[model samples]
Target: PSVQDCTICMERLSAPSGYKGPQPAVKPDLVGKLVKCGHVFHLHCLVAMYNNGNKDGSLQCPTCKTIYGVKTGTQPPGKMEYHIIPHALPGHSDCKTIRIIYNIPPGVQGPEHPNPGKSFTARGFPRHCYLPDSEKGRKVLKLLLVAWDRRLIFAIGTSSTTGESDTVIWNEIHHKTEFGSNLTGHGYPDINYLDNVLAELAAQGITEESLAQEKD
Candidate 1:
């Protein structure tokens, strides 16, 4: 028989590995119970998933609602709910209307490489490169995400292996993420990392229903 897969962690089942996870009391018949784009996972794994999606304290589908977590949209700008709920990106052919919220702590940065701190905090970036939201802008954003992992702010900015920071390029990324033109381009797919994150958000109960209720 084929092994069952865990959708949340994208892992396959096996005899206990040299790690920690509960052995199921019953063979899972998840083939019938699993939801599409959803995963059947251990409670511990589910908690980890929850923590990952709750990065900004808001829980929402990374795929559907464009970009919102457990809160916002439904409620007025100032008011906020105390609890987190499953949320999904609003299903639309166009997700440009969506924007993800990012918190900027006093100290944070991105990965280390030829291009450092590329997609770090949402602030202090120029607006030109960010505009148009093209492949280039997203590439920059991805780089920054990598850089932010390292918390290397000073080392941030797109510098070449030649050891030079491309101010023009860096500033442009800043622009696009912060203030850019209405140039919507499509290079990312629905099954990419962002969408994957959204799927988890959906599991958290941050769906369209939450948005509607929050606005009330």
Candidate 2:
């Protein structure tokens, strides 16, 4: 069977890898197949791609986005708590609300952090976030639990708002912090919040499809 081009470097599988980094010691024509997706790519290209990333011992297929190993993050230790709230959010009056609370305290950074041995400030302890208990919202919650398990919810870095170094910040995933209004631009009334959050979660490699793949 003829293998398609390597999506990572956009080169035919039979040819040498297009990776221009320090050359890997494998045969130029050697290719590797992803176990789950069965996609083949030049071994050298895969090595370069993995090196260019966080190198957290995981590989994601560029063609099908299948994750090969557990994906983790450099988020400092924290607590994630969630429960059902009786009151409904402004725009989601049809169902009850699910509130998630994240609590991370000030701590020294580790080797994986941006600055090891430096103190990182967690500005908001027990930050509150919300979502409706609808079907899609529950789906998002399930995926969110996975994200938290992988430590992808928060990270240690400089605060974009205060410009303070060695601080904790939200890691890409958007949350609605405001309870009643959209005043802070983080609140509700936006029809696309659920879908938008799903997209954000997918961008972090925490999609529902990936979750199912893990189960398999």
Top lDDT model? 2
Q: At residue 165, what lDDT does model 2 achieve?
A: 83
Q: Which digits, one per residue and each the tens of the lDDT, describe model 2 over residues 1-216?
A: 135787877778878778777776776677888888888888888988887767899988888777778777888888999999998898899999999999999999998888889888999788999999999989999999889988899988878899988999989899999988999899988899999999888877888776796589
- Per-residue error (Å), model 2, residue 92: 0.8
lDDT scores in order: 0.32, 0.86
Q: TM-score of every model?
A: 0.28, 0.77
Give stretches of model 1 more than 4 Å off: 7-14, 17-38, 51-210
